[model samples]
Target: MDFGVAAEDEAFRVEARGWLGEHVGAVTERRAWERALGAGGWIGLGWGEGGYGNRTASLTQQVVWAEEYARAGAPPRCGHIGEKLLAPTLVAHGTAEQKARFLPPIAAGDELWCQGYSEPGAGSDLAGVRTRAVREGASYRITGQKIWTSLAHEADWCFVLARSEAGTRRHQGLSFLLVPMDQPGRIEVRPIRQMTGTSDFNEVFFDGAYARVEHVVGGEGNGWRVAMSLLGFERGVSTLAQQTGFAQELARVVRTARETGAVRDPVVRDGLVRLWAELRVMRWNALRTLGSTGDAGAPSVAKLLWGGWHQRLGELAVRVRGAAGGVGPVAWSASAPYEMDADQHLFLFSRADTIYGGSDEVQRTIIAERVLGLPLEPKGDMG
Candidate 1:
């Protein structure tokens, strides 16, 4: 692939860079920042593929936006689950009314969404979901628990996968339902404190939570297909932004090594150079696989490459810091008694990099069976 940007895409990069440099520093509030992006037409960069009516950027332009967004040092997006994942799915499989009703608020940044897919028992094996939704007159009542739900405490709505029909097993009889989170007694969110001393991930409970029948996407019993489609969307332009963030983190680690004289050590120097080169490979791989949705294993390959790469980067972050990495810096007294420094936080948090989303083993299994035509691994009891 030619790495050079087209003339038009270069223009878009300049525009995005200028806007982000001006506004990203000024907006610190999460929801307000989302609104500013929405008003500035920065959200929903790829709705046109599904024919949703928005100013659609080409795939390369999407890459430009994500790269610029990351390079601008903007805060982590609080509304990405809605804007990137759900909006595309709705356009692909939702009813006209569903699209018309939900897409506007998402683009406007008026609503926030969380995913309710991973359960305590069904995280990596998503088809093992046990959450059930019982249909009533005009609505379905959801009852079960979802663990490791990011942004659950702040979300206004959640798209859940639940067993909606009796006698269903594995991926069968499941429905994708969008349930609101404002029902006081029916829903509860408990935070999951990470080793990094933050609670951005949550455990969410649904006790007879209601969702309108119209809110179900891809119809009842077709949730597996819809959910898989959402997974495909995970490899969109956002991966470019992710790589950009990785570049920034690696830069910090390189600076740390230089400042502390760690670069003088042969091992440390080798690690730093390798990380820098591998990041470029990842960027190229991401660019190569951007629009190749026909390749079932591309996403898994991408996942496997970056997941372990990030974990190694985390290790290097601490290695360069030496014994000093063990000490936690007082970065946030309000949230926890002690806070981890940048290196400490990176080391601790990225331990989960290979575990969440799709575990390393799971991604490899996808590549083995789907890409290489290898025999599938035999199923075993979870017990």
Candidate 2:
């Protein structure tokens, strides 16, 4: 892979860098930050303009934008679920009407979306989704619960995978529906506080919430395919930005080590060097897989590579900090949860890096069964 940026990509990198530097800290509210990004035509850089609010750019240009955004320490995107995941799915599988109706708001960052794929009973086993969406006239009345739903409290919409037909099991009779979140007394979102003292994840309940029939993507009873397609989209350009963030965190850890003279230890120094080298390899791997749409295991492979690497970084972060990283704030009977520093928080929250999104076991299974053409794992009879 070419390491040098092309001239055109260099120009885009400069523009994106300049714009992010000027405006990153201006709109602290993510909703307003999203509007600002939309106004700058920064949202949906890969989609068409018929959405009226989307922008089109080359893949390299999108990569440039992502790297620059991370370098600028830009705010985490609050509109990503809509623009990155949903919009692409809409373009691919949605009806013309669905594209026209949903794409515009997402491009403009006017709508926020959350994924409702996992449930208490169905995390990696998505085919086991039990949320029900029964059709009622021109709409479907959805009734069920979703767990580990990121950005649920802040989202205006949720794309849910639910069982639409009764007496059907596993992947059969499922439907994907885009349901609104403004229904009073019909839907509820309860935030799930994490060990990092953040509530970006939530548990959402849908009690007969209405979703228009036209909102079903790729037709009814075919949600498994669409959901899987969206998962493929997961390994898109933002990975560059994620790597940049990891670099920054690693830099912080190195700085901490140097401050306390830990870097002088040969063992500590060796671990740091290994992490740096592994990250470079990970970056190269990511670049090699860009635009590899036909590879069934690309997304899972990418996830496997980064998940363990990140967890190790977290472990090393706390280790570099020695005992201090292990300490947390006092817990006085009714006091708030512990507020952690950068290293401590990274150490704690990153424990989920291998677990969420898709667990290491799940990714390996995908690589084995899909990529390696191995026999399907045996499932004992449920009856």
Candidate 3:
């Protein structure tokens, strides 16, 4: 993989950086920034052809754009799930009609998407999903509960995996359906409050929620394959942008260490150096894997690397704060509850880093059974 950023790519970076620097904070400004990105034809880079602003962005150009966007401290992308995860899957496996209907809205920053994959019993073991979507005439009536659904309360649509054919087990007889979230009385979203006092995670229940027959991508009984493909997209170019955020967090930790005099501790200094070095390794590894063709195990490798790294960074954040790290919010009260500081939030949120988006154990299983060709773990039957 080439590490050098081309001159033209650098030029595009400068252009992107300038735009982001000019307009990227505040709700109104971020909305305008998104529209500007759409108007400037920068939203769908590397998605290929059909000109929803993805006409001819080379891989390097895409990387440069992501790196620049993160460096600018741009507002969290509202259209990311559609633009990154769902759009690419649609382009690859979706019907032409599906593409025409969805891609434009996503590219224009007009709609948002959230994943509807994880369920109560099927978080890491995706194939264990029990959501049922029964076909009736032109629509599928979906019924089941999904937990740990990120942004379910905010998403316009959700690409769901459900068991369409009954009596089939494991990875079989499933379908991928794009279900809308606006169905009154049919879909419910209950927010799951994180330790950071954020309600971003949600429990979503679908009771006869409907997805049109044509909205199913990759055909019937192919949900497993299609779902795995989308998971591959989870580890794509956006990871480079994520690294920039990680860098900022690390910088914060280092600054805290300096300010609190924790840097004087030899052990803390060594930990800081190690964190910096590991982050560099992560960035390089992410860049190296950018051009991959969605190999079955590559996503797991990326997950294993970054998940553990971020978890460690969270630990380092608390550690550098010395004894104060153990303390909660000031003016603690029973009625009001304690709010977490930035580092405290980081430490709390990062505890789940290894557990979500496929847990560390699940990642290890994929690498072992799929990548290393090891035997599958033995299954026990309670019956």
Candidate 4:
């Protein structure tokens, strides 16, 4: 496939670059970026032309928007659950009425959404999710717990995967439901703190969460299929935005080290070089996946590589800064301590990158079985 941008893509890129240059500022804080994205319509840059997007735009146009926005120091949209994962899945599976009701708010950033697929006992084996949604006349009463839900505290609604039928096989009984977080007895969000000393992720308790029958995205027994589609989008389309942002951060780290004379040290130089090479490979792999001409397993490969690269870059930033890094205030300032704190936070957070979006081991397993055509591992005996 021709990776080069067509004339239309180039025009779109120019337009995006111009728009970002006018509206974007030097804000690096995640919360600030979220608000800015909501105001600027950069959060949903593929919905329509009136809202900083052209709905008929090509995927290349979307890629250009992501690249330009990231280059301009804008936070990637994946940080927002609604715009990144749920919205796209809704577009693909939601009924026309559902789309009309949900898509506009998500596009406008007026509503936030979260994923409710992973439960206490189910993560990598998503089919094992046991959250039950029993149909009661006009509504379904959902009763279960969802763990590791990112931004659940801030979410307006959740797209949940629940067991609608008990006797059926694990994958056969599930259904996708859209539960309104604000409704009575619907969601009880409890913040879960991370190693970064932040509580962005949460555990949500659905105690008789009442959702209308019409809230189901797809029909019963289709949750597995819908979830698979969402995961593919998460790994493939989302990584493009993430890789671009990481590449920019890597460049910033390198530039900071050089300007600060830290690159004079051989060890620092070597670490930086290694990270740079890995970052380049990640960028290339992500682009390949986004282009849709690469191996079908490219997303798994990209996620694995990116997880490793994030840790490596974080480590290099610390080493390059040395002892001066730990002395500054936590906020983003021009001091060495500030930079060090940022790197330290990133280093701590990077540890979760491998674990969150299906762990590295899971990705490797997928590659070996699907791409390399390896024999499947036998299931362990629970008895």
The residue pairs in collision within model 3 are none
lDDT per residue for candidate 2 within 111-130, as digits (tens), equals 99999999998887888888
Which sections of candidate 3 miss by over 4 Å? Answer: 26-33, 294-296, 323-338, 380-383
Candidate 4 lDDT, tens digit per residue, 70-145? Answer: 7776544434677667766777787877777877776655677889988777877677787899999989999999
- Clash totals in order: 0, 0, 0, 2
The TM-scores of all predictions, comma-separated, are 0.95, 0.95, 0.93, 0.86
lDDT of 4 at 288: 65
Model 2 clash pairs are none
The digit string of per-residue lDDT tens for model 1 on 1-383 reads: 58667897888998899999899879899999988888888888888854443467988898898889999899899989999999999988999999989988888888999999999999999988999999999999999999999999999999999999977788789999999999999999999987676899999999999999999999999999999999889877899899999999999999988888888999988988898898899889888878986888889988888888998898888887783344333234676655567877887788898999989999999899999999999865432
lDDT of 4 at 308: 81
What is the Å distance of residue 97 in model 4 from its true position? Answer: 2.0
Q: Candidate 4: which pairs clash? A: 48-53, 328-337
* Candidate 1 TM-score, true structure as reference: 0.95
